[model samples]
Target: MVRRRHTGRRLRSDESGFTLAELLVAMMIISGVLLGLMAVQTSALVTTAQTRQRAQGTAVANQVMEQMRALPWASLSKGMHASFASAAGGDPNVTSSQLHPVADPSITEPLVTSTDQTTDRAPLSGAGGSNKTVEADPSIPGFTYTSRAYVTRSAQTAANVLTLTVITSWRANQTTTQKHVILRSQAFAPTGGCGDASNQPYLGACQALLSGDAGATGPTVTVAAAGAGPTGPVTTPTTPIIPGTEATVATLSVGTAGVGLTSQQATAVEATATHGGLQTLTADAAVAAVATGGGRLTNSASNDAGSAGAAPANPADVTGVGSASPLTVSGTGMSLQLVPASGTSANLRATTTVSCATGVPAGQACAASDLTGGGASSVVLTTGGTPFTVASVAGGGSAKTLGARFTSAAGTTAVGCAALSGPGCLGTSVKRTVGLTSVGQGPWTGGAAPSGLASVTSYTDATLVERGLSQRTTAGVTTRTGTVSYWNGSGYSTLTIDRLTSTTLVTPAVTTTVGGVTVSASATVTVTPAMSIASHPDPVGCSGQGCSVTSDTGTLTLTVTYVVTSGGIPSAFTAAASVGSGRASAAFKAAPSA
Candidate 1:
């Protein structure tokens, strides 16, 4: 194709594609929109990260709550706790300061996380940094959660009711600011159980509670209702109603009076004398009667004076609050006196007239009477495991038979018996006395017998006897020699047996103190010198031919006496033994004629 020449011309604004200034303005607008979109996307990503961390915090809080629930009642102490050390430093066993309180309005809430990387001087980029947790978000490298717990007991229910609060916190994107979640729960521990010290009064009390029903009704109430009327009732008989005759009255009577107003002195005096020409008499009249009846008496009279059944002019105004009336009685010469019982003390005395079986001269005192009909009404027991001691004699001079009580030694450990108590319940202590242990001798050995007599042989015989206490030992030895004889067809055959015995006593005697009482044990033993033949000729006599000798044996007796003394009382025991009880007999048998 051929080229053609064209001339240049100006175009309209609508026809022009673009200008440098317009292009710049348009580029700036497009860049602005793109940057705004990018900013929104970045914000969305951060929000998603924060939400994920919040979710993790919630899970961590729940996990801490579960841990608190797993702890037994005995291990849980009151106050805040954390897996790591707390910011508000204190005894970690009590309260922790690891997760510190939040900022500003929510400062009361302890929401600070352990891995708040910004709080420290250096960046908490590594897992080894302080306040870092192993439970870090694997996807979000440096993010971690911190968990804490608090425990408290109810005022009304005490340790039986426990409340637990768990908190979990974490830093948002490794910043100083933290987010957290809280959870609260409660735990219960049964009261009056075997572990409680108050529930145990003795071995029996704790044991009984182990098998007792905590919800059981009162003992007097026959049936247990949904809502009982009282916690503990003395007596509320539903069946077999109590009769009025058998029922007890609130107030007791003194003699014939409905009230306890009669004085002891007034009653005793009235029984012994007459007053004012009337058969009934008062205390003053009784004193006068005693004076007239050849018995000297001194009177102490005030309110009633010498009048019988007379009321005082100004009687005690007991009706008014905190009012009192004073009556004074003073005298020196008196034949008899009576005293009332008081706090921490008691006294009683009486004397009876004596009529001698045989006549006695005047002005001479009668023979002293023998006391009788008196014995211990009750016994007081002390705490178990106290060692027994002689202390002092309970019965005074005249007592022939005395009583004593014993208990286990001190530091004695208590044990449990399935037969007496339920599982985990302790039983009473087991006590045993140390006593005589053994009496024995050493073994016998064979040896040569005495020679000189034809066909005579001897063997050593040994005997032993010994006695000892629990903490002692003993030894002994004895010996005897004897001859055994047997008859053949032609003559008598004899075997001389000898015994040499020896024994050593380890402990001849021993003494020890038990409960302030001296105890001693000793042993004495002796052996009989004479030996007796225990068995004789078994084949009878030799029959018309040769006779052969056989083994023979003799026996001796050993007597032993053991003595033990305790608290000046001595006890004796005896024992005996026979030596060479089982052995061959000294006998000859006749051979068959050839």
Candidate 2:
């Protein structure tokens, strides 16, 4: 066959392969099919990896539960459990750190391997990836897991029942799949609610204790050294149970023991590390609701591990109490001498709180400046999660919102980097840091710690806050008042925190006439924090008092008014009132001054 072109050129059958338009169309069709296939394959691979990891997580959680069951009830109730690790790199036999859900050049492919099951792990810094397959050693697979446990008293549930939740976190791939498989169980008072009819050794002791039987010889109860060693109530006869004083102690009561107890009732005494009032619920002995991993939040493939999990307590105090006094700030103006947990808190995302004593304010935080001065400075950050809104909500959904001052990823720097942080003992075996910095149009000028930081984790009375005034140092310290305590979660005894202010105040005297009479009046203004530590409740005391912190009421409003004097009595003037606004928080004192 022969085909003639538009220009009248003739093409023979052998010479005619195809027209340009036809060839182009054919290529496009083939490309579309190939792309579709590729997409399907990618999806399948990701799904397969995710499913495999989740299954492994479930198994690990179950294994932890088994360990808890066999452990002495006292040890389980202590609530200190080790975190599980996953195999590090290619060598499937030894376990290292389970990679965080961020791309790491060190890890070949984030997967669960054989050694990841609690025993075969290395440290956080030792793993890099290798080309290995689970098929080679059936025990080795690509999925990795981290197991965490949280044991606490069930809310409004029985006192004898403890909720043990074993959490398993697994990562299939940083970009694809990461999930937590939770397994929960309830451990009852081994002595059968301490209500068992049998004359159990503690039965008599519990009856004597609960019945207020003055004649009863009570069991010896003791608080571990600052509450480090504690033996719960359900131990054997020889190791009779006792009470501890460092924490809240709850006791189990028998249903029939109170007024109508035909016999001595069973009971279990328990203690835990929560500062709130003791919890008492009258539910049945075995009543406990289990989440069993049902509650889940699957990241949108874009959320990084750092942001995916609950943000670890915000490390905002720029200053530490080295050998000096504790850190304090008055309102948003003053900066703390927060020592880098590693070396320098360079690029860590943080905000200075003015009105946020108890917590941070919504749109208020976005307006804060960075920590600068001293040895450190506030470097500008462009990328990170927005912490608070104009309404002061961490996960903001408010009428008013304040954009973060420094919100660029490029601004983020690495902490403890030899090249970035410069020499000295840069936390090699101590901490992990992703340093961040931002100046963000801040009015705050940061400073350095006067003394060196503690060699280890130690709590000090160093953080001190003076009431409202206008100076960072004791020079301008205002009226020191009020007793406040903040529980710093890391095993420290309750530390006393005083509300101090570093902001200056001005009061004015004015005279206004209402109703044709000369009047002399002075406006009294008392500064109340738009938000303070008392305003919000946080069980986990932290440095920054981050996300979960409640929002602050916007603006401190001072009402102004002049009263009308009728003869000798002062009458109110509604229309003559005046209103003014100030910062939403109070000044906080950080230390005794370096």
Candidate 3:
């Protein structure tokens, strides 16, 4: 504990004065301390500024998330940045990314935010507050605050629920890495519609769905395909809901019901009306038109099978009557004659008095023309005088038919959507009563041979035929019956369709199906991801860490929530939502070297 002092003058070794080297060393240490202190002060100031910006960014993110949570499910669509400049709820990108099926895309004032705002929003007042915030920028001294929102189904595990994530970001400093503050929330599409209708998107979507069931004649409502993108919403059956007596075939179930369904999947409709404690059942469908009935020809007992039916034309002695087996007469001048229609004449009568289909009447002089039809074989009457003129009949192919056999199938074919949802599709049954296209032969074409064994050369032969067309063809119908079930989300309903009861018989098109209720080729609804994206300067925006370090290439993931169930058909089904989004970017990076 010895104290030493030094004067301004240089001193001897024993005088206790400091050396030049010691002074130099002390000066060097002090200079180093001062420089270090200055550096520490500068660093602390920079750190404080960076921390403030980050805090502001986090606050902004929480503010946005709180605001989003208050919105309806309809607003939880895939998108990035949207400006609240107009009533349009949609920028081109926001519009294309809408989830719910709606017509007017008026984005309400609250859903959109101003990218040019100067203040950070308080957690309570999301619009804005006194928290000072910097404009989002990637360049130079000051930090920039940028924000964005993303919606996706892939990130969510619940049905009828969507994930909404708000990301607020800023650069720590000119040389520091960018930072981000992310806040996430969820929105659900409730049973009533648009998840309670808090915002315009939710209200519009819910109203649109209800409007789809408008104009129906009954209280039971059928939820059909609606809006743009997809149709034929098989999510719910066409129930007697809304405001009619069509009957409540079924109702929506709890938890989850129709999961994956669309309009194309609605193969049938079932309705039940209770009267006096008894329920009357009705089941049918409306589909596109398919070809139905046709005709075919067939023969009956008159086709000359085993025994001679009723009466057939009997060939007698006539020179011109052509028959496979006929009675022939000799003498070149002899002509053919015919028996009267009444067949009671004992003597020959005038040509007009007696009637025969193939021969001249009795009494009239036989003319040379009467024999003209007799080919190589000639038939002459054994009782007739020689040189008399008569008529002749030519023979041709003969195989008579009864008419159309009425070839038909059990089920019919059809297409199109039923009445409901929106202006989707409609079809006609097209009960085309097609004509008899072709004819088939049976055993009608035949001729009588004498039981006494008289040959064509021996018996008088005259050409006589019952050929031409003896039967008519007609189109016929084939009937079929079966049972079907309808699951309207809540319960099941059974129905029966019978052709016998024309009134209850299915008159709707697209009714024919082999298995269960109709199934859709694709989902009745679809939510497109972010589209039509663009970059806006601070007072503009992008994504991730501030507009400077992030890019709003305008891409997004979609999460659609819907339900489907077995609508009491042979096979129950569901409707599944499709998501099309992941980590996508237009930013360039160096190729990874192996």
For candidate 3, write residues 446-488 as lDDT tens digits. Answer: 2111110010011010111010011001011212132322222
The lDDT per prediction is: 0.27, 0.24, 0.25
What ranges in model 1 sit over 4 Å off? 1-13, 77-134, 153-160, 190-594
Number of colliding residue pairs in each model: 10, 75, 79
Give the number of the best model, judged by TM-score.
Answer: 1
Please give the lDDT score for candidate 2: 0.24
Every model's TM-score: 0.25, 0.22, 0.23
Candidate 1: 10-residue stretch with minimal lDDT: 212-221
**Over the stretch 1-594, how does candidate 2's per-residue lDDT look in tens digits?**
899668776878889788999999999999999999999999999889667656666776787666555443333444431322222222222233332222222322122222222221112111221211121113444545665444456445576566655556654565455555656676655545333444232233222111000000000111011111132122322220112111111111000000000011221111001000111121233533211111111100111123443322222322211111111111111111111111111111222222211222321121111111112111111111111000000110001111111111111111111121100010000011111110111111121111110000110111111111111111111111222111122211222212232221212323333333323222222223323232212223211121111112211111222222333433221111101111111121111100
Estimate candidate 3's alpha-carbon lDDT, on a 0 to 1 scale. Answer: 0.25
By summed lDDT, which 10 consecutive residues of candidate 3 come out lowest?
A: 210-219
Query: Compared with the true structure, what per-residue lDDT tens digits does model 1 show for residues 259-282?
Result: 001111111100000110001112
